[model samples]
Target: MVLLEHPLHGAGGREAGPAAAGPGARGRGLVPGLSLSRSLSQQQQPRLGRRDFRLVSSLATTRKTAGRGWSIRALGHLAGARPRVGPARAVPSCMLGCAAAAAGTSSPPRCRSRALFRLTAVSDPECSGFWLKQSAYREQPTVRFRYEVLFVATLGPGPGSLLAWSTFPAFNRLQEDRLRVPLLSTREEDKNQDGKMDLLHFKLELPLQPTEHVVGVQLILLFSYHLYRMSTFVMQSMAFLQFFSPVPESQLSMNGDLKLNQRQLLHHCGLDTRYNVSVVNGTSPFASDYDLTNIIAAYWDRNVTTVFSDPNPLWMTGRATDAPFIINATIRYPVEVILYPLKTA
Candidate 1:
């Protein structure tokens, strides 16, 4: 973002006093070479004076016009010629010129007050699987096992006077997917010691079962400004990232006899594998037996803690189950899997 400073006016300089009075001003206690009281007395003196009201009126008009010109110039300088990334457009040069000319005339334009706020765009790099967890099943009936993960982020104070947080609606779902957690909480922190607030946080939650597989995830982040009266200013700063797992393809299928490819496996599991893969499984019938393979990829598992910290702070931890076989042991099928970035508005 660009920030411009305005020059200070009326600083360390001699100011012009009231305009010189004319012949008419003499009648109103305004005159050169005479004290104000004496001038008033002379105007009231019996049978003695001629009043030049037109001359006094002209002086007042000149003073008012000069003051107006000074004010207009100051405003024009403060509102730089360039346009920022907000709703307001740049003030036309012609308009400013017209105002200057008017201020130089006898009838000066009235002053109007206006307020403006600056916006800053900020975000951190995407952090991959920061949390992981896994658990084994004993004799539990409700759930045999569970898996969970978490991500964290940290944001600093903005460079502008006013700061606010807003998420891009189009990228909200993608963020949830990449983080592998439900959007639960958000908070702002004051980190600059400027006696002001600046910072944001998001919390997510996810559940996993021992019999399920791991698949890739995509996420995105958007930044904007929130003004008073429910108004908002959109920004261009955005972030995107994808997560991947290290599991081999041999362990991604249901049976040892299925010839499931990555593409087909992901398709059967309703997942995109080109970008990130969490789980995959496929089974095929061979000449004399059945073959199967399963694939799984993820940043964290039941034993690790993942923290996503950069733009903001997010903590995630979870457990996951191994790829389990399908109920139909002898069935043969083809599977395909692909993962990539999701489209953004």
Candidate 2:
């Protein structure tokens, strides 16, 4: 039995009930040639910690100047028992648009609302997964990345003139005698002691023949990336690096950041595992499945990816004729500010 009033229109204007607002009197709006109508949800007791309870309302106004109709819909969340009736407060315009996405229905061009409603418990900690005890979104993700390495060093620019190695047994099998295993070591560090790794220290030494001289380097590192927030996003991503020089290089040192790259917007709510697949089919028996060209092309086609951003990679000359080509790399995973949409219960 609550009465609602428009802010722009004075108390002398027409009023509407809580449950239903019928067509208002003519010339009810602040505008000279406009009419207004509004409807509000009936009060009800919402089930606690269950499915969401949406308080739906709509306003439709006709404009004589534009010869059009404008519609506006609002959605409020109701939780627990029936809300206690109190003084009504004006809701911001942005909050009114909260239900617009859920409504999916609009009048011609839509109308604006100057109505107000007393918003009670709009969200519940237990139902929204934000404060749940076992919820993944309760804390920062303890990301565990599985890694695989692949490399190709070109001795010369001519075709079939490169040496390659891979951690994949099938890929190594396909390489046959051309396979060159390097001495590799890796270690991860938690800089701030927050139980999450901050960076990885990687070193690799590839033995070379006295006549071999490396003029180009290509490397691929695959990782299983994920985020547990509004949505549990799981994906297999890669950091691809390529460097070429006319002169033979002694060593390559890289300090880079492996950051997430998103092409399409992720879902506001749901589990997203669309890219949860191996970047390279390690168990495949065919050589085409392990082709670098095919792998890079497929990885880029994904909506989400990881890239290695190294603005300054040091390439030192002078191999000393017998020293193995060395690769020293430091890849850091910096903290990122993720903006996630919160759902009203």
Candidate 3:
């Protein structure tokens, strides 16, 4: 006579043999080939009855291969609704069945079936697996800056008694009478050869008349910043600096760091352009668009920004009559830690 048994224990159906009654036979706790049959008969029937039994039987009968076992494939089939083995990830379905069967539970099929569909992705075959609640990472961004300067050189002690110039065409147009174009030399350096810019050297030389003197200065620089690790983030940001003194100065030198200022959390994934707009509207001919007060106010409204932190500046008072007023600045960009949600499949 033939005895039908689960592949988990033995082959399809076969008669008992001498090897079945060997020394380890008792350790298996089975009487010849009738062990699995008796155990299944003793267990309580599931809600689906024979259907659940057939499902388990059919799932277990699939062809096996090397490097991989039957349990993982079976679980993936049931969870992903297909016979394809997915990513090297673990799910709760196969574990539930193994645990239920080992513990002699009343309903192993029912327990496993529920867990099989718990974390399944119906549409995406790649994203089918159980995973942790969340994850994060760190990143450093690539930054490129452009010169957008505005400086004031006073000639006398009155409101409109100063010479000024800016890179903005609109602002320079308004200051045509007092405007003086400066020769700007700017370059970005990657000290570590890591592809990301680390430092910016800015040097500007503004020619002056013999009697003209500079007692105050105001400057602004713009940057096109981007991030690519967690999400694609783009924005136009700026750094502004201003200082004035009663005594006239021949040169201004500054050294500072261009640091990130974030007031809100960034998105875990996808493109973000909330602060991507220009800091100053160069296209607009309106004087308000070029107003320093208006530009700074609009920039402060953003949740993310970059600031120039210069604690001490050097100002020299000795100038030859024919010499030009020089301004030298060094801005450094440092590495940063970013927290983002991890993707799973």
Report the candidate with higher lDDT, 1 versus 3: 3
Candidates ranked by lDDT? 3, 2, 1
Query: Total clashes, candidate 3?
Result: 0
Residue 104, candidate 3: alpha-carbon lDDT: 52
Residue range with the least summed lDDT across 10 consecutive positions in model 3: 63-72
* Candidate 1 wrong stretches, greater than 4 Å: 1-183, 193-197, 225-236, 248-345
Give per-residue CA lDDT, model 1, range 117-190, as digits (tens).
22122231232121213212111011000111112221122222111111323222334433222334444444
* Residue 307 lDDT in candidate 2: 86
Clashing pairs in 3: none
For candidate 2, the TM-score is 0.60
Candidate with top lDDT is 3
TM-score of candidate 3 against the unseen true structure: 0.58
**Tens digit per residue, CA lDDT, model 2, 188-248:** 8888998788777878898999999999898888777767656778888877878899999
The CA root-mean-square deviation of candidate 1, after full C-alpha superposition on the true structure, stands at: 24.8
After aligning candidate 3 to the native by TM-score, how far in Å is the CA of 144 from where it should be? 0.6
Write model 3 residue lDDT over 143-219, tens digit each, in one string: 89866666666767888887877777877788878888888899999999998999899988989989888888878
